[model samples]
Target: MTQPRIVLYSALLCPFAHRARIALKASGAVYETVEIDLKNKPAWYAPNINPASKVPAISYGAPPDSDVTKPPAGTFLLPESALVVQFIASLYPQIDYKDPIIRAKASFAQLQWDNLVAGRWRKYQFEGSEQDLEPLLEGLKQFSDSVPEEILGDEYGVADIILGPFVTRLFIFANEDIGKWAPGSGPKLVSALSGPEYDKLRKLGAKLDKWPALQETIDNDILVKKFTEILKNH
Candidate 1:
């Protein structure tokens, strides 16, 4: 059997792209990464790869040197972050996609996390309005409180893969350098959310702490450095 080749176009800071990259890593499938310049996107992504011009697009095939057009048999471009993660998870079913029920549960968990980030957490980042982040913090608090211990498994799964990027972003935004991005009520927002529930999430992620592969992905300071370089070039 020919080794399946997976190519990922991604940016380090992008949570969406982060999902695809981490999912691919967790799947233990060999893949090549093409770090996209999100500030100035390449032309190939506009029409062929992703019409929306998103950062993360997975192509399974040879590199620029090869002639193969189509990807490996049974392979297709998975675009959206949530879908991309699910697709990679499905590829290596033996790892975590053990049974139908587990698969469904994991999918549900992924969607829930997506919703929480999109609806609540993102508002604090993108929206620079009154800067009253109490609502946002409360929403995340609810999210953490709702999760039970059973879900935070000993082995890594979609639960950690989906949340890691956003969690890291939140931590960075709360830190000294990036804290200004939050402004007026951001400190309160961070304080409120970084509670017992937040600890639970961290505890869940503890298994990831020792894993070099996972650490390499969520290295927040490294991402800050990368983003700094990107900003300069732009």
Candidate 2:
């Protein structure tokens, strides 16, 4: 079976876009990458590609060099990182979610992370709270506890691709004790998340670090510096 021509419009710093890159690399798909500058986007990007002007967009069934901006009608233009990653997985099932059980676990993990963990993660980092890290920590504990058995086991599926990058950042922030949170908050978060209770989550981040896609897609030191910039502005 031949893979469709794919051009990934991505940004290195965006966690959402990072999921697409991980999926692409894990699937071994041959695709051209057009790195997008989120700050200074291309003039052609919004109208020609994603009207929302977001990274991790995909233009399929279009020539990689066609018109540079005007992707012809009928090109399957896809936006949003979760959908994009699933689309790639659908195209190459062998690489991800090939088993129904794996799919179920992925869905479960996604829900738990979004409902329990995601929002608190943002709040803890970008806004000051007397609660400090408690909100984020509690959310993480529940998220970890709710995951299905073997979710962090031998298989790497959609859950890992979608959530791993952000989780990795959390680990880094906690270890370095950096961010908009209180000065010592970083080490506190890391210490708790690293305890045996969160071992599965730790394993997930470890795998992300060891993955081939992650070698270039994720840089810990760079991300720490990047988040420093973001949190300072808040």
User: Highest lDDT, which number?
Assistant: 2
User: In candidate 2, what are the lDDT values of residues 32-76, reduced to their tens digit?
Assistant: 888888889999999999999998899888865586467899898
lDDT, candidate 2, residue 170?
Answer: 76
lDDT of each: 0.64, 0.80
What's the lDDT for residue 179 in model 1?
31
For candidate 1, the 10 contiguous residues with the lowest summed lDDT are: 175-184
| Cα RMSDs, all models | 4.0, 1.9
Candidate 1 residue spans exceeding 4 A from truth? 62-75, 95-109, 126-131, 180-190, 197-199, 205-208, 225-234
Where does candidate 1 clash, by residue pair?
A: none
Per-model clash counts, in order, read 0, 1
